[model samples]
Target: MTPGARIAAAIDILDAITAGAAAEQALTQWARRSRFAGAKDRAAVRDHVFDALRRWRSAGAAGGGQSGRAVMIGLLREDGTDPAQLFTGERHAPEPLSHDEAQVPEPTPARGVRWNLPDWLLPEFAESLGAHAEATAQALQSRAPVTLRVNLRKASRAEAQDALQAEGILCAPNPLCATALTVTEGARRVKQSAPFAQGWIELQDAASQAVVAALPSGARCLDYCAGGGGKALAMAADGRTTFAHDIDAGRMKDLPSRAQRAGAAIRLLDRAGLEQERPFDVVLCDAPCSGSGAWRRAPHGKWTLTPERLAELTAVQDSILDTAKDLVGAGGHLVYATCSVLRRENEDRIAAFLAGHNGWFCRLEQRFDIQQHGDGFFTAHLTRVKL
Candidate 1:
């Protein structure tokens, strides 16, 4: 497909998305109907759709209206491209712009639009990050880096890097963790790479890996909210006895296979199983949150999150911390983590947890900011004063 054709496809998908269809579903629908579109065409169209989502407010403003055509026009204009080239009346291209649409309007001078965030979230970001809020907001407007964690249980960092490079999946060491690698090129080839299929590597954000690296070594560990068992598998790579559990047991249906593929032994526990195996040496609660830090990968979440939803998430976080604490024995680490940049979800939750419980104090804490390397993540290590 021509570049103009791709833009036209993006506009249609965006229109469907604006009309309440999910971005992924809309894109899938488009792909299903347009069997003539090649892989690169589909990828380009998907990129355009997500880029518009990441800067929806700003793009809508610049494009002169809320419609998908206007937003695509605005996106092209924002990138200093001539929208006229893509919105031509030629075959397979977007319709020619109307006279009013031809005139690009100056974007409204609103912080919410400027930062491409919901109006209610602007103050939250400000309160959470202060001076770094703008940078963090800007970072979320771009794509996240593709990162992988070397399964040290299978291969050394150097060895994994070499194997990945052999398959054209270029990578460099990530500073967030010794076992982490940021894919520099050919990231799309990673799934087909021999290293990945052989369990020499696993795709995970560097910041997420850093959270595991920060945990105090223990003979036995439990991931209380182990959705997909990423952290549980990571912990097991160190030869620790790792157990995984989630309130929704269905979320871990693939965990057993994943653990086997990674050559890591991770025991899956239901509520009854967890109750039977009391008091682990370390318990990690990777609670759910607004997912603000990962908005780059799931931009639809930014628009969908509401104050009520955030409140509900905070309550869940608190409850998880409260329940997971019971499974931590004396002197054991109760690690709380979230992939959210908002303090209300991270530090504030930790503060509340410490306030409600006696004898427990945070021993170490770290916040990984969104940068060229990884998504924002916060983790804190809490231990009962070992009395």
Candidate 2:
């Protein structure tokens, strides 16, 4: 398909998303219907769709309307691309811009539109981030970098780099963690690369990998909220006795297979089983949140989050922390983590926990700001002062 055709496809998908269809579902439906579109065409179209979503408010302002055509035009303009070229009336291209449509409008001074976030969230971001708010907001307007976590048990950093380079997957070490690698090129080929296929590397954000690295060492550990078991698998690479548990047991169905691939022994535990196993040396609670920090990868989440939903999440985070504390053995560590930059979910939650619980005290707290390479993340190590 021509570049114009790809833009047109993106416009349609964006319209579907605006009409309440999920971004992924809309993209999938488009791909299934347009079977003639090749792999490159599909990828290009998907990129356009996500880019538009990431800057939806700004694009709408620049394009002068909420329609898919106008938004696509706005997105192209934002990227400094000539909309006339892609909106040409050529075969398979979008319709030519009308006289009025050609006159792109200046973006509104509204903070949400300018920041490409919900209006209510602007103040929240400001309150949470303070001086760094604008930088964090701007970072979410683009794509996230592809990163990988080298399975230390399977391959050394040098060996993993060599294997990735052999398969045309260029990478460089991430400063955040020893096991982290920033994929410099050929990221699309990583899943099929020899290193990744053989479990030498696992796709994970550098910040996420750093969270595991900072965890207190213990002979026995439990991932209290192990969704997909990424951290559990990371912890297992060190030959620790690892156990995984989640509120929703179904979420861990694939963990056994993933553990097998990584050559790590991770015992999956249900609620009953978790109760049976009284306490662990270390318990990591990678709780759920609004996912504001990693919005670059899931831009739809930024728009969909509401104040009520955020309140609900904070309650859940508190409950998870309180429950996970019980599973931490005497003098053991209970780590709380979230992929959110908002204070209500990160530091605020920690503060609340410390206030309510008498015996626990925070040992270490760190926030990884969203950078050109890594997603926003916050983690805190809490140890019982007296047990």
Candidate 3:
């Protein structure tokens, strides 16, 4: 299909994407009906849809309206392209822009559009990040880097890089962690690449990899809230002997296959099983909270999250920590983590935990801010020092 056709298709998909439909779901639904759209067409259309989402507010401002067509026009304008070229009145292309639409508006940004965030979140970002707030907000407006964790058990960093490069995927060594690689080019082809099929690489963010890398290596470890078991897989890959459990046992259904593919062993346990396997060498709580730090990847969460909802998440986080604490041995480490950039969830929660547990002492480990390498993540290491 012609480039113009892709643009037209993107406009239709964007309507669904902006209206709360999952981006992947909207594209899949569009593909099901449009048999004429090829794989290339679908990928191109998806790019347009995500680009519009990444800069929705600014794009809406440039296009003079918030409709799908206007946002596409705004996107094209931002790229200095003539929208008429795509909105041509030809077959499968969008209808020609109206006379009023033909007039390119001034490049003015929406109020607080630079942050590319909802009005409610602007103050929160500022309060959380302080001086770096604007940069953090601006970073969320762009796509996140495609990061991979080199299965060190399978291959060395240099070996993995060479292997992936041969398969047309360019990966750069990430400074965040020894096992992390940032896919600089051909990232979209990774899933179909030979290395991926062989499980030489796992699509995990560098920041997430860093969190597990910081853990004190132990023979027995438990990921107390192992949602999807990504961190559990990474910890297992490091050969620390990993076990995974979630309050909802169903969340770990795919973990067995994922672990097998990555050549890592993860023991899946339900809440009852976790209770039976107490006093582990290390207990990790990658707790749930407002995913503000990860808004770039899951943009919908930013708009959906509310103050009340955040409060509820923190309560759950605390409970997870309290429950998981009992599973750690007398000399074991109880690690706390969250995807939230908010102080209330990260530092504040840790403070509250220390206050509640008289004998516990925090190791005050590293924290990662959201940037090009990965999403915003916080991890703190603590150990039981007393009765």
Tens digit of lDDT per residue, candidate 3, span 43-154? 8888888888877878787787888899899889888898988898687889999998888777665547777777877777777789988888778777888899889888
Assess each prediction's global lDDT (C-alpha) against the native. 0.92, 0.91, 0.85
Which one is best on lDDT? 1
Candidate closer to the true structure by TM-score (higher is better), 2 or 3? 2
Query: Which is the winner by lDDT between candidate 1 and candidate 3?
Result: 1
> For residue 360, what is the lDDT in candidate 3?
88
Residue pairs of candidate 2 with colliding backbone atoms: none
lDDT of 1: 0.92
Candidate 1 stretches greater than 4 Å from native: none
Q: Write the per-residue lDDT of candidate 1 for residues 308-387, one digit (tens) a residue.
A: 99999999999999999989988899999999999999999999999999989899878999999999999999996777
